[model samples]
Target: MSEVITDVPTEAPSEWARHHAVPTREAYRRTLLDMARLDPRIFCVDSDMGGLEDGFGQELPDQYVNVGIAEANLMGVSAGLAHSGLLPYANTISSFAASRAAEQVKIDVAGNNLPVRIVVTHAGVSAGHYGPTHHALEDIALIRPLPHMTLVVPCDAAETEAAVRATADLPGPLFLRLGRARTPMVNTEPYEFRLGEARLLREGEDVTLVATGPYPVVMALEAADLLARQGRSARVLNMHTIKPLDVAALGRAARETGGLVTVEDHVRIGGLGAAVCEAVAEDHPCPVRRIGVPDAYLDFVAGERSLLEHVGVSPERIAEAACDIVGRRG
Candidate 1:
């Protein structure tokens, strides 16, 4: 269904996506393989869960270690590998990879500034039916305060792949957030996704929608539908990377659009909303609407649909928030 890629494609996000063969996790794995091939010292330490669609369990047996159910050991071993000079990527569910092993991550990865990259899967409500145990709703908050760490939340499969490729050579600790569902592949068509740069999906004068990670698709579609029905134009910005935010873009949007709305799957407090507020508050002060989970744990939902609806992250909610922000309510 998806074509394989040896190198990044040269097409635009508006063009047909040429390569989608690799899912986000496998994309990270492929990057790891590339690094491992280039230097024999590169290693990957996985929890029992790295049972990917194409498991690299055997091909790189010596370079791979699958520790069963022990998230803490994965952090410790990854730190040890980093201390010994082999760049390692530790893999697990985001909640466990970050929260369950916060001390090890703080002491070993952040405290020591290890070159270990933590690839967290099933981030946000994308975990769907796995319930609260698997839903990593607070992962961004958990990793935000750590020092010497680079935080990234990629928009689609392409950005995820690029983030993986980029983190391979980056110094110090890095945390890559990924989704569980087959999110829209709109971002696959080559955008210039530098480390902390944000991409402007649309330009508008009425209002701006700053969306991050997988939820940008929701916001983009909502903005388009709103434009069609009410002629209420909305600018959508893709803020994949959470930390080191694009203050210039925020300034332009604040000056141009005059109002703002931030949509993300993570909690409202230490995420994209907070980052946007900090930037927009300085030069162009505007009314900011944050669309995300509030200060409460998400309840168990039947599926992703019920999950998003329960927490109000659906496209309709986003459109409503956009309209409310611009005073366009019918």
Candidate 2:
């Protein structure tokens, strides 16, 4: 088990938090590289992901393995490495890692309870131009049910770095979902990132906005701002850890806020929205509205921003959904 750090920072937001300069993948690579350099036991197993070749591959050739296009083999090799007492960070696209090599991930990693970090990039609709084939629409749903698996979806590059460092020595399988595009930093102010614990971004009394991933959290914050202007105090919770969810936080929201709205970049059926509804229904039932992609294939070609907008995962749409949920209470 990883040690939980609960020391929250009390300083003002930094200037780096105001910029959207670093891609989450880049942060993951840099942090992985730094850790690998200090610890020779850390190995990086890749599946034709070219971004790590220059830094990780060249700097530590013996510690890197490119399995070439075979995602199942990638997981298998990583599991083998873990069995030999070495920590491995398996690299692949989110769609392939969750779909093609899912069986290996479930059995080889999760079943054996190995400490394999499955760091997948291009999560959800981040690979928008690649069509539905590359989109990780159902990854959270597929991985959430597996035993001994820890799911984490960081909101930005800074949080991605914090998550990588925090979960480095975690015991058991981990799924770290990351996006391909550069995203603005959400943790501008000092904050504590505890595994399986939800971070409270903003406090409100009317409704709570729960979200994960980079863009969804940004949209949630924007929605909270919009709601504040309209006399609706909206609370924002960055539910970064999907599996082993912060149920206690949900209970508090249900009791205090009375209503909730969940936002995610994936489909509504089995992603963050579904998880939130499932948790709140049995424990503390409240009026909840989910804002996410519909249950269907997106056949159109567009950029990440365009696809997210079409799926109604925007600030305007999230704010509207929050209003609807709050209005139902009145």
Candidate 3:
């Protein structure tokens, strides 16, 4: 039998190449489409792109519904589907899906605790070339505050597939953040993946870098390289599942590292950093650094690289922050 592990590409690594298979967000949609093939009860609602780029409509046309460009109506319709005992997966850009449909998600989805899965594509700096309007820097912060919402940001396509499978088991409002670009898969070793459980990618003793989404892979790479250069290691944790934060692992890292640095392709406020602070500050107080887009929108004319560097969330910036935090502790 052809094994799934053997299917992975066997190639040489370059100095600065990311081994990105499928974009995590697209993989989620593809997996969902495959699941829909057998489960006739599955329905997908698109916010224009579903029929266009996502290709979800191509697989299951009868179960697919497009709500034009009206996001509110789309959420309302999806919630209604969930209430009627139909599992609905809504697809849209991250910003529009979360912030634009905030009320609908809070009321129709969260308020009712319905089994409506919201899959956000082209999230964060991955949409950088498209400009800040398309960048979903605040989506994570916005969605975390809502009740009955399981916030997730899968690190890679494989984990994304695992996340989709997990979503099928859980029955409630789930927000899965996915990027438009191909991201490097960090987890080659298999584990029992689940939503709301944090995955520890790398171990260290100096400091802890708690990151979510595709950015965490970059964080791991940065930490590894930086540790080799400085002869000091930093632990990195992939807090993919944000809602039910793995406080146990977080507590362990906090005790081990003493210093915490959170990297996210999100807002500095109400995002992964804030969540870490809330979790860490509950009993023990430690110095924490939050890395993400600041308060102001990137209205300035710039590409994705510029936007991230300007906001100081780039890999280099993350390394610098880690170095600074580690240096200060000495």
User: Model 1 residue 190 lDDT?
Assistant: 68
What is the per-residue lDDT of model 3 for residues 64-140, given as tens digits with 9 covering 90 to 100? 99888888888999999989989988878888987888999999999999999988887887778777678888888
Highest lDDT among the candidates is held by which one? Answer: 2
lDDT of each residue in 154-182, candidate 2, tens digit only: 99877887899889989899999999878
Q: What is the lDDT of candidate 3?
A: 0.78
Best by TM-score: 2
lDDT values of the candidates? 0.75, 0.88, 0.78
- The order by descending TM-score is 2, 3, 1
TM-score of each: 0.88, 0.93, 0.89
lDDT of 3 at 114: 94
Can you write out model 1's per-residue Cα lDDT over 230-270, one digit (the tens) per residue? 87788888887777678888888888775788888788887
